[model samples]
Target: MARYARSERESLADLLLALGPDAPTIDEGWVARDLAAHLVIRDRRPDAGAGVILPPLRDYGERIRLAATRRPYPELVDQVRRPPWWSPVSNRLVDELTNTMEFYIHHEDLRRAQPDWQPRQLPAELQAALWRQVGPLARMSLRRVPGRLLVQSPGYGEFSAGSRGEVARLVGAPGELALFLFGRQRVARVQLVGSPALAERLRTARLGF
Candidate 1:
């Protein structure tokens, strides 16, 4: 019943404002302002959002996103905080399913990019919610990874990905595993257990969408 998506969105907006527009984020070449613009475009601009996943619309999406960045930084963060009620992705009915992981991951993207940042002690319910998403994410991100990959979140569950070859295991809390699968491997606090070669391969493999 908790609206994790809303909470994460608000928290991320708060952090974005606190850090100012120039703060770095885990996303390459993007700063706090850029990330704020991205969130707004994602939430309010469905036509532009399509470019995020559709190759043909990419340039148009980039143009819209770049224009959004020209707005005042605080205004952009405010938009990220308060998505329009009619937003397709952030509407009350679908917001939880759609935005929970999206906001959580981006929240960490900003947090982990900062100096002296520490991992959060997430609520158990949120961890379970995140765990439920791990399997699908792993399947998509690791589909091309060589060898068998096992992802485990103690006290939650496990998921297997990749075709057979050597076996590799990724162990962490559900949130950490989610981060790893989302291509934040360098910042994700997960352990890889396998042959040295297998471990290295998993570590360096391009994971996430």
Candidate 2:
């Protein structure tokens, strides 16, 4: 069985090593070093990683992450390249379920910041997997949206989001829709249609996990 998450993790680690520490990523204020440290910390130190989404512990997590960033860049990337088997997020049983989208999105985060970047030709199965993962994300992110929001991926499937009113449609491939939903709207290539104002509002709204 193929594990796309492992492939993506290795590929991203390779790219980060090649790019060096100073390279920019789509993540605001994060360079290659910051991103590498993030991956390492997430896999190696579950306690610290938990704070990434928990406000109360976020400051402490940031401190630990900053410390990790201070280590040699090569060391950080090396850790990312070889996540321990015991890691909650990297263990074989949960790796694919938890990390496919995580690695893909972060891989793109690194790739898209460079010049003349293009989307990869992901396998249909992978696209379908991504589509399934994004539905719940769309629901959560757009739950409070002012108008009805529809996210559609041609030849795949569609998800209706938001709370009420007029409908706004966002159409794209699953990968593109994932990028859009993850707050990469400025760079994601997707068609937005419906009421102009509502569409714009949906486009401009803050999104992501």
Candidate 3:
């Protein structure tokens, strides 16, 4: 079976290597080397990865990530390219579940950072897969927004988000909307419609994890 996660993982690895360690990425304050180390720590260190989402463990996660970032760049990128088979996050059974969207998002984080970057034509299946992810993600990420949030991915489908007040509709491909909702607004090509002020508010609102 085709695995988008693995394909993205390998592609991202190759890109990082070609760009070298000093290249820029969409992640603020992180260059390619920093992003590479993040990937490694995220998958190989379950304890540290939890810190990515768990506030109490954030300090520990940051400590481990800092150590990983200190390793030689090439070596760090290689580890991201070929994760150990026995690894909890990289093992076959869990890899797809844990990494599909993770890799996709980070891959774009690299791609969109470059000056000449352009959106790739994604396969229908992959778009659908991405659509599925942004559904729940939009709900959670936009929960704090003071208006009704509707995310529309043309041809695939759409989902409702936010809790109350005026309704704001966001239109774009799944990948684009996902990036926008995740705070990649500078790079994500999405259209926001509804109240002008509220729309701007949603656009400028601190989004993503």
Candidate 4:
């Protein structure tokens, strides 16, 4: 027989519960507040058991950029569930698996504000997922720019370091690194990897909310 949820899916809720009150979040976009609202609102909807909010649930990446360019933070947070988010062009069907992704995605945003940034100790499965996403993204990022160091985000334990010994260091708790790699630390700090360049790329990169 099939179960409604698997161990992997069940772990995400445990992960969310593990997050502290002060995780990193987007600065101008009410990223944390919106995430909080999403968690609260979506969970309440009996129809959507897992409360998945995919990137597709958001505005076109372009639209989010345009909106970020024009809107005030107060208004932006207020608009969380309205337009763009629920719009057909962006919303994608998702379940708990996708829901877990959202938690990681949004948590990264929150990590920026947290200086003593720490990625919660992920269960083995989620830890594995974090490892999988970081390398490809980091390699692609380095090709476009330059950074001569590697860091192990806290909590997850050190998995890999591309190369070592640069003038600067990529340092932070595991969650912070995970969040930064995923592009949410734009509004927060990932401690530092090498230069302001790392943070700058994160800020300038056209990552959508």
List TM-score per model, in order: 0.96, 0.95, 0.95, 0.41
Top-scoring candidate (lDDT): 1
Task: Please give the clash total of every predicted structure, in order.
Answer: 0, 0, 0, 17
lDDT of 3: 0.88
Compose the digit string of candidate 1's lDDT tens values, residues 34-130.
Answer: 9999999999999999897799999999999999999998889989998999999999989988899999999999999999999999999999999
Ordering by TM-score: 1, 3, 2, 4
Alpha carbon lDDT of residue 16, candidate 1? Answer: 94
Write down the worst ten-residue block by lDDT for model 1.
200-209
TM-score of 2: 0.95
How many clashes would you count in candidate 2?
0
Model 4 CA deviation exceeding 4 Å by range: 1-27, 31-102, 108-119, 153-168, 171-173, 184-209
**Which segments of candidate 3 are over 4 A away from where they belong?**
none
Pairs that clash in candidate 1: none
Model 1 clashes, total count: 0
State how far residue 146 of model 1 sits from its true place (Å). 1.7
Best by TM-score: 1
Clashes (candidate 3): 0
Could you give the C-alpha RMSD of every candidate to the true structure, in order shown? 1.1, 1.2, 1.2, 9.7
